[model samples]
Target: ISFNAIDSALSSLKNCQSYINSGMDVATQVALDLVESFNDEEDVNNMEKVMLEYATMDRELNHYIKAFEETINQVKREKPENLPDLENLAQEKFLEMESKNSDLDFQRNEKYMYFKDQLKEMKKQYHGNDTIEEIDEDIAVTRSQMNFICPITQMTMKRPVRNKVCGHTYEEDAILEMIQTQKQKKKNVRCPKMGCSHVDVKGSDLVPDEALKRVIDSQKKQ
Candidate 1:
């Protein structure tokens, strides 16, 4: 495929993602409406079921997008010239990529999960049967999902940055300040997360953790 074709394919994947996100937003709104508009158990259950069916579609579509992203990236990096080679390469890489991933990743996707949790609350309100036990379970699970506290600042991270080297995140300013301090001392800092083996921290190793930030923001709103 031509380079323009590759770029267009990637752009199409992005549009797919955007449409999925829009669907999620609409689902959340529908859940809200159902909560207020229905008191019948069967009706509410059916609406929730329909909502979940769309959610499943979203999950499957996202998986396809990820698989295609992996295939296209491999094709671009290798720069295969001919049609047969590109077709074979894409198929082989797609199977390899699909083998390494599953629907679970999309289920745990931050934006989707965030919308799901909101829908759950609306469901609870619609049913008017949220037991203390279930709420307790939700609290416990939410606590265990992620640690938003920055290792360097020991506070809830507002702008988290993750290290590409170790998959650990810290508050952006705090990590940058630490980096600046270490540079002034003509030395390097290790990844601050305990038990991490990354020996040196560099600015290039840190990237913005936008997904984590969105999760954190959603938690704060709750």
Candidate 2:
């Protein structure tokens, strides 16, 4: 399939996932309220299992879709058999299919195991106190951990530029100036992000993180 077709399908899958997750969230709130009003342990346990199954099913379907998309993109980029004489590359095609399947299996197994670990952690919760407030707290903490702010300026990045070498990001002007100052002095500036293994920043190593910039813009509007 064409890249546009693959992207459209992925978009649809993402929308479906969001729809399911919204419904699951509503159902969870209702379930929790019901359990609280009735104070029934059995119903709470059953409802939790149903919620887990529903979320897991949605996640699993999306994972397979993502794997398929990745495989197609890989095939286009790598072109396993681009020989002009070999018009019939059936064996090469089969090999690509096999590789895709292998990747799908590996990813599914790894994520499922991680999911089970999450379930175990949930089971360890003293009670179902992981409510909306708790969820909001978790979300906030997660966002704080994300690299939305530039390390150089200690501010929210307006134009985030990511280092290709170290996978860390900084504000575009700030990082460029840092690089320029070092180059003029005949020295290299290490990555600003603490504990980075990457030796130094190069002008070529920085690229605009357009995807992250969009996210930041959306959040600002919100």
Candidate 3:
């Protein structure tokens, strides 16, 4: 599904590029015609105006081409097989952190509470009156936080896949493997997400989440 969407977007970008090239060609021809139309100094001024317009359009075209290339490269990089086993890596990290000291868990929880309080205070400071701009800003921040990491992997997702049943997202291969392993164990493949109420999740519940994948890619670039 995501591959098809990427292909469609690429095709559209190519068509737009071709159209821009054609427009530049037409502009160039018009500039040449203006050059031959008159010998007066006024003709020189007109030619200069045409040239400036052409330059502006050319810059815009180049910008779009560069953007398209970046998008294609991002999509290619987000292929599922290329992503690391973030779930296993995160588990290893957790085990190492725990083995070093049992107090680490308490410290982590305390830090989470401290940060949550700080965030609340900041939000109150910035959004005292709950104005439209403040509300929009808050929404944007919440959305960004949601897309920044995968719940199961506890890492920034490369190729995100959505669980349609519960509207949760995870790294594609991680979720698939989880589902397969759960199925082999002969247990209900419920969502592994904490606090999620979803049950009886199956492999078919997962879908390639292209929008989330793009968001992840964009966040990584930033």
Question: Best by lDDT, which number?
Answer: 1
TM-score of model number 2:
0.37
Local accuracy of candidate 2 as per-residue lDDT tens digits, 114-209: 223222223223234443233312111111223678989999999987675666789999999998999999999999887887777898867665
lDDT of each: 0.65, 0.58, 0.52
State each candidate's clash count: 0, 0, 0
Model 1 root-mean-square deviation? 8.9
- lDDT (tens digit, per residue) of candidate 1 on 69-101: 666677667766654454555566556665676
| Candidate 2 residue 141 C-alpha distance from true site, Å | 13
Against the true structure, what is each candidate's TM-score? 0.48, 0.37, 0.35
* TM-score: model 3 vs. ground truth: 0.35
Model 2 whole-model lDDT (C-alpha atoms)? 0.58
Model 1: colliding residue pairs: none
Off by over 4 Å in 2: 80-222
